[model samples]
Target: MLTIAPAQAPSAADLWAVLTALRLLDDAAEDAAAARIEAARLTDETRWQAAGPRRLRQALTEYTVHLARLADELWFQRDQIARNALG
Candidate 1:
């Protein structure tokens, strides 16, 4: 006969850590959005400038894109954790 063990409930400390992580991820996402907006504004303002500023703006934009993607993944993970916790 095969037997299955019941799932253990998360400890208070474990739940606290998860909640803290979720908050941090939310904050990071907000910061990423803000950075993207600032980058767009700066790029527009420096549109008539020389190549150096343009290159810097391009790099900033690329980094912000990566940050946004990371934030998205974190948020998805947060949601999955919350759902699993509830179950």
Candidate 2:
């Protein structure tokens, strides 16, 4: 007769790898935010007279919020994995 075992949870190293990737993604999001700010500053007042600047800022804000949420979730997961390892 053949038998099967239950699948194991992710190892600490695996969790670390996910955390590292999340950090990299956060770094990229930060870079994007900086670039967006610089681009807005470089735009002329005439362009701001239109709706472009307002729309761009709104989009940037939304994207930043999304990134923040993702980062928060990743941090939460990383902490949970660490606690599981310890206890």
Candidate 3:
């Protein structure tokens, strides 16, 4: 599948919505990263523990991976808009 999404220049209202969505997506990615960091710290705190902390780390790993992918996709779309506008 194509990783980049095409973009169309939006009207003022649509642009606002797009910006808001981008902000939210960025925030989500950041939150996921924070979760992963927290999970790492938790693991460090209990090195021998294999159940809850490991599960939490796994969840954060999944969340961060997915959100980072989404953030990349969204940023690609946003950049496409800039390229279109420039060209």
Best TM-score among the predictions, by candidate number: 1
**Candidate 2 lDDT tens digits, 39-70:** 44543332444587777766666665665666
Per-residue CA lDDT of model 1 for 3-69, tens digit only, reads 9999888899998887887788778777876776776677667654678877887887787677667
Q: How many backbone clashes does candidate 1 have?
A: 0
Candidate 3 weakest lDDT stretch, 10 residues = 78-87
How high is each candidate's TM-score? 0.69, 0.46, 0.51
Overall local distance difference test of candidate 2: 0.61
Off by over 4 Å in 3: 1-9, 49-87
lDDT: which candidate is best? 1
Cα RMSD for predicted model 3: 8.4
**For residue 51, what is the lDDT in candidate 3?**
88
For model 2, the stretches where C-alpha displacement exceeds 4 angstroms are 1-47
C-alpha local distance difference test of each model: 0.75, 0.61, 0.63
> Which model is ahead, 1 or 3, in terms of lDDT?
1
The TM-score obtained by model 3 is 0.51
